[model samples]
Target: MTLEKKQPTPTAKPTADDEIDLIALAKTLWDGRRKIMFYLLAGAILGLVFALASPKEYTANTTMIPQTGSSVASKLGGLSSLASLAGVNMSNVGDKESLPPTIYPQIIQSIPFQVELMNTPFKCPDVDQPVSLYDYYIDYKKAGVLENVKKYTLGLPGLLLGVLKGEQEEGALLDSTLASSLISLTEDQDKVVKILNEQISLEINDKEGYISLSSRFNDALLAAQVTRKTQSMLQDYISRYKLDKANEQLKFIEARYAEKKAEFELIQNELAIFRDRNKYITTATASTQLEQLQTQYNLAYTIYSDWAKQLEQAQVQVKENTPFLTIIEPVRVPLEKSKPNRPLILIIWIFLGGIIGTGTVFGQELYNSVKERWSE
Candidate 1:
């Protein structure tokens, strides 16, 4: 007798909610509370270790306002006049000197400028040590031993060294053997220049035509010195270039005026002599010659007068119209460090760590459940 094989009732398909039983998950995690605690403890330790290993950063800030004074009109006019004559329309002619407040920052923060700074001495405060600012930046680029250890622990140790150090020498190796590093300069959409590192931040406020040059460094004295030197460099740039064209123009006008005056005087003297000699000699021919001489003298005198007026205007314009720059408020030494916001950083780190930990725990549990079901 072919007995109809009773089809086994298909196991009730697990619904979406039933697949991940919240009550079961809570029980599983709670039953493995020790394992969970181990993970939490490890995360907390990582946070604490990272917090200690991280370098403290400092920031220095200063505001610059356009200086208000008597020189504005003259400087602005001079720049405009020169540009206008040259067929160049300067956008900020009525405002600050173009070189100082406008073009100077671009020049100063350029690669060549940074290379120049590299050759010069700059002072910066170290983590309980003192260093030249150049060296400070170089050192800041290095991965600290503790930082290396953490990175290795996180499975993201950098190339070259990770293969060399591996897990064995995580925090033991020194970074002094590496080549000296340089600070990177970047500009934002708002045109603010940033020279940054983990330990220091320099934010340049270039909005008011006066650069509010701010920097973060450990040393107050060094911060002040940097700010002052930056300003000086900016001035040096302007003094070298902006005044050159104006001075050249003035010199040219002065020479031309002198030459024109000399010629005018000579023509006047010639006309006077002709009149003195020919006044009483009343021939029709002499009268005609006198009239002709007078006409030439008048023309020469008019030309000379126009030249004289131009010279006066040129001189006034040079004196008044030179785009001048003056520091409104000089940067002061910063008293407080700008970085190492402990609470904020800790909160962020905790949140990130929690997410990673939770993901790992759940991912492992899901994989185990799927494997068991498939095996059955």
Candidate 2:
């Protein structure tokens, strides 16, 4: 049986169907070149149209270096320990209260800040006259066709809901009286705020102690104005926050000083009257009365003097606590458009079109292969 099995075993040869043919695949793609080119051309044309229709935006930027008053910390140094012992926290003591540059972005995005910005009048190139940003956005601004298309497509649900709700009455959802409270925002106000938020940007460099503020708008001058206004508003807000305690102290001191001054003056007048009326008397009871009046005058004068010094000190503290914003690079009108990068847009479109065309060609091949297999 072993001798019979000594015959040679035949080796299996590879079949043509099992081998991959790159040339054939290439030919298949070449056969659909027209379809591929058509898709690519369509994509490119759409991109060009979008690029042409897109609105131009101008960006204006300003750089600033915040001047932190370390003197405030020094002034509060002695009080910090006392405050801690009394279970009262003091932030200004030992650089604790000094806001970091990072929080600046939050300040710009704050509701109160946005409200003020919206109410601010901006010079628009398209408009014959300057208009408040709120009015400009709400009344005059027109959405582009593409923007409307996107709204109807991606934002359809929201749009439909808004329509169902009907035109909201002014102040129906928002309490304008609470604007000073900053606790709430109305729907209209919120919309304007959101728009403002999109238009403004803040960049902080903590290590360098500098900040860059930027604003984008349809008009170059308006963009520059907005940037400058934002810087001013930020400076004002920070200054008010920094000097809050000092201002309160000053107010109290001023009120006390006024009361003391009036009391002192009244006492002086009384003392003078006593002296004038009792002139040349030379009696023990009269001398005693004179001494009593003199004593009262001295006490009132002393209290008034002390408060005067305190009032002066409080005034100094207010001045010292006021923060200064040193503008490194002031805002200027942009000469060039900041957005609508046409060339880049065109390139991206072409690249996407090529990808889509290639995918279409391969997808067609896959569909045909599946169909043939199913038929078999």
Which predicted model would earn the best lDDT? 2
Give per-residue CA lDDT, model 1, range 199-263, as digits (tens): 22233455534456655554567767666666566555565554564455567557756866787
- TM-scores of the candidates are 0.58, 0.72
Span of 10 residues, lowest total lDDT, candidate 1? 185-194
How big is the positional error of residue 106 in model 1, measured in Å on the Cα after superposition? 1.7
Every candidate's CA RMSD: 11.0, 8.7
> Candidate 2 overall Cα lDDT vs. reference?
0.79
lDDT of candidate 2 over 122-210, digit per residue (tens)? 88766778898988888888988788889899999998998998876655665667655546666767888988899999998978878
The top-ranked prediction according to TM-score is 2
For model 2 the TM-score comes to 0.72
Q: What is the C-alpha lDDT of each candidate?
A: 0.57, 0.79
